[model samples]
Target: MKTLKIGLLGLGNVGTGTYEILAMNAAKISALTGCEIVISKVLVSNINKKRSLNLPADLLTENAADILSDPEIDIVVELIGGIHPAFDYMLTALQNKKHVVTANKAVIATLGDELMSAAAASNVLLKYEASVAGGIPILNALSTALAGNEFDEIVGIINGTTNYILTQMTDFGLNYDDVLKDAQAKGFAEADPSSDVEGEDVAYKLSILIQTAFGLKIPPLSIPREGITKVSKDDIAYASQFGYKIKLLATAKKNGSTLECHVQPALIPVSHPLASVSNEFNALFIKGNAVDDLMFYGKGAGSMPTGSAIVGDIIDIARKLDCLPCCLTPQISAPTKLIFAGEGKSMYYINFLVADVPGVLGKVSTIFGDHGISIESVMQRSKGKSEGEDVPVIYILHESSRQQLDPALAEISSYPFIKEVRSILRVEPLN
Candidate 1:
């Protein structure tokens, strides 16, 4: 049996969880992999700071070379969660012929092409199962298990903070600000939640999934996304009244030659499988030509779940050295094109405040007709403030291309009768 050395970068929450898991279960994991996994060095910002998990102080070092340059370390597990030095560190590790495992979705999504090519040149594994969906192992399933099938669609609730906020808004009828405060207080959100609430986090993850599934490296920016920051209590109430739920949905689907990918708050019928997912939980509803449909569900983010994913990749790397991992498949990257936003079609929900006056609805309908946006349903509710005052108006439309809605909605928003565009979301029709 061999003892594999692992140098961990960024000993934060995930880093601590990885160290604990490896130390506590070393014997069992070693038995499984036929090699003892050792945490030889850990790169941290402050080595003297008190940590949750206790290890020998000597294990901590601030220098990347402590791990990157260590000749004895075979694997470098990076949990730094950002792109700057973490990217350079992982890149250097690969150039040094060391296998790498990371939970940095930002690095993987943005810099995956460079890193993957480096690993290939070095002939070592660059695994990042923890980068997407926390511990769901969706990356592995896409790259290896589902590799045989031609994937048609991947729709997911991959952001835990946004999902938690939306759940609180739906269940408690709270506004975005209130639920965001609750999520932060409960440790589900970061102080700066722009990444999670603004939909950047889900977009990064979706980018990783897209490239992994289609073997393409579409830039994350190209996947047009809208966040849940605009979702309001009235939209939640209106959705519940209509027997539907609101979720921040990340979607990727192939149409002929162009892949359609986007992230936004979507209205899903309550009976749909993804509609039931709530409160910091994540689920990816994958549709493939052979598998038909598959859902992978789990706690999308947490120290241990992410750590478990990191260790799983570490084990796979060890097994590649003849340690007998369950499945050892590498991610392959190629090229493909994606459709621009508004070029695709989907049912949509638009909530706006309009002057409660005669001819206002007619003018809105006239604009819709001008743009060829077919309205599926409409709900008009007075706020009981004043006569001829603004009240909330909700519109659910049939499948219409964004090309049809964009101009019409822009024109409606400019109308003096339309007070404000409260919310706009896509509706994922029930299968």
Candidate 2:
């Protein structure tokens, strides 16, 4: 069998896991692919830094040119987690006619079109199966298995860090800050977890998903996103009382000639599949015209899970080394006809503090009626309200757009009986 040498970039947790997987599953991988896959060189910042993996002294190098410019390397695997040098290195490798595989979602979401065009120009395949949900082959399924079907909607709990934090808050009644600290301590979150907690990470993944499923390239920043920072124990308790769970959901839907997409903290029914996906696990619910509804669930993030995705992409490219480069023209195309509608109508959960008076709900109802908004349900507990103290009131509003609801909320906020609007979350209809 011929040999396919690999040049690996970065040596972090996922990088180490990739090396170990190749080493442990060498014989099986070779037997399956009919190629002896090997990591010929690794790029690191400090070549002298000791690693837990028993790598050869000759294999480590501080220079990236040794891999990017080499004629012998068949593939360049980029494990670096940023857009700066990783994007440049991948572009250079593709320009050099070397096949490239990466797990960097930021680069892919931001500059995927340019890279795909580069791969097509150079007759090389640019594979990034590990970019979105780690270890879940959702991209492969979308590009190949489900390619025939028209996807109507894609809803997923893609970020494991935020999901873990929200799960802890729902299960144990813990606050967001306390659960976030726990997540960081347990290695589920980064020290500066603004990316994960602020919903930017999910936006990146959603952008990739939009391309794969809808054949549309929407900028990640353009997707309206709301983080889990405002989610509190009180909100979690209220959701339970209403037979729902609060989860940060990445959602995209197709509506005739327009597409709607957003990432926000929403309330899903207790019986929904995404509601049971707790802790660090992930789940995606897809609606296809032919396949009906399909849900993919598994470990979304971890060293080995992400590494498994990387190795899978490497093997895929290795098997096609002798064949012509597969065209990604359809994969990276922008939506020409479909209009990008920001966010569509949905049911809402509105919580606010108000004076425990008889006519407060009536006045609020009048405001909502003036704005053509209807209430689905309302809940108020008498146990927490003292004779003169303010009490919390929850309202589950009927389907209404943000444009219609915002004015009513603004009008209600000016009332003297209103103390504060505690939470405003969307309620997703999963059925």
Candidate 3:
């Protein structure tokens, strides 16, 4: 039987899981593919780091050059979650004419175009099925399964950490800090949870998805990003009162030749499919010209789930080698102009903590009207016992472009009667 040799880069949680699964299912994999897959080398940070699996000592090496330079290694699996050495290592492996697979979103989001070109040049497969949404197979669906159709929009809860925190906040009325602490303790969040909580992580994943779905390759920094760090219990309660749920959503839509991509905490209608994606799970709602609306849901992150995606790519590459003429080639096209926040039209939910005095609401309404933004609905809730202190007023505004509302919001912020403008969330139409 033929044998495919694998070189692993990192032995972190996801990498270890990949090695374990490959070992445990070796016989089954060999039976299906008519080939045996074996780990030929492992490049880790420390050779003395205690590993749970009893890997062959001869296969271990602290130097990445050892794996990249080896002639016997056919595939290089990079599980290192960073830009520096991981990016450099993958580039080297591709240059050496070795098939490459990685789970690093940072590398894929930033350098995917260059990597794809390198793989095509070297005539080797570059698979990153594990980058965006873990175990979801969204990339495969977009690139291969739905390649026949023109996709319109992709909306999803792609980040598990923010979803978990928001889920707890909405369900149990927990605060952000408390739930974030709990998430960290439960291993759902990292030591420094800025990337996940600040929406950078989701933005990175969305960049990859948007590239695959719309053939656009804008960096994460180019996309408008807003986090759940400022989201409060009051905001969640108000959304509930208005028949909506607050979810940190990554959305991309095509308009003519332009693509709009943004990641932020938005007010999704209670009836929307993504509104109910709670905890660490993820769901993607995709709209295509031929397929209409299709949903892909699964565990967004975890060692085993991500590992499964990597292994699936390995198996696919192995199988394709037999009949396919060349390695996987990504469809590269010119990037479409991104719809800036200043140009898009959408409705908004605005909450104001104002003094309980006459004409305060009228003053706020006049400011919005002067800017050509009309109010859809307004709800006033009494601050029970502290009636004379302040009151909460919530307004749902009609569909208006950011060009109009941004100036209006800025002017309203200076009003003395308006003690605070607590929250402003964009609302998407249901149906």
Candidate 3: tens digits of C-alpha lDDT, residues 1-431:
99999999998888988998898889988888777999888888988989888887797899998899989899999998899999999999998999999999999999988888898888888899899889899998898889877888889999999999999999999999999999999999999999999999998998899888777677887888899999998889998999999999898877676676788898989999898899999999999999999999999888888999999889988887776554455445434455433126778999998888898888889999999999988988884647587888999999987788889989998988888888888888746
Give the distance in Å from residue 346's predicted Cα in candidate 2 to where it truly belongs: 0.8
What TM-score does each of the candidates earn? 0.95, 0.97, 0.96
Mark the regions of model 1 whose C-alpha exceeds 4 Å error after superposition. Answer: 323-330, 334-343
Best by lDDT: 2
lDDT tens digits, residue span 1-431, model 2? 89999999988988888899999999999998999999999999998887999877799999999999999998999998899899999999999988898899999999988888898888888988888999899999988899888889999999999999999999899999999999889899999999999999999999999988888879999999999999989999999999999999999999898899999999999999999999999899999999999999988877789899999988888777766545422245333477789999999999999989889988998899999999988988668566988898999999999999999999999998999999999999878
lDDT of 1 by residue, 143-189 (tens): 77788888889999999999999998988888899888878898889
Listing every candidate in turn, what is its Cα RMSD in Å to the true structure after a full C-alpha superposition? Answer: 2.3, 1.4, 1.8
> Which 10 consecutive positions of candidate 2 have the poorest summed lDDT?
327-336
If the candidates were sorted by their lDDT against the true structure, best first, what order would they fall in?
Answer: 2, 3, 1
TM-score of 2: 0.97
lDDT (Cα atoms) of all candidates against the true structure: 0.86, 0.91, 0.87
Quick one: how many clashes does candidate 2 have? 0
Model 1 has an lDDT value of 0.86
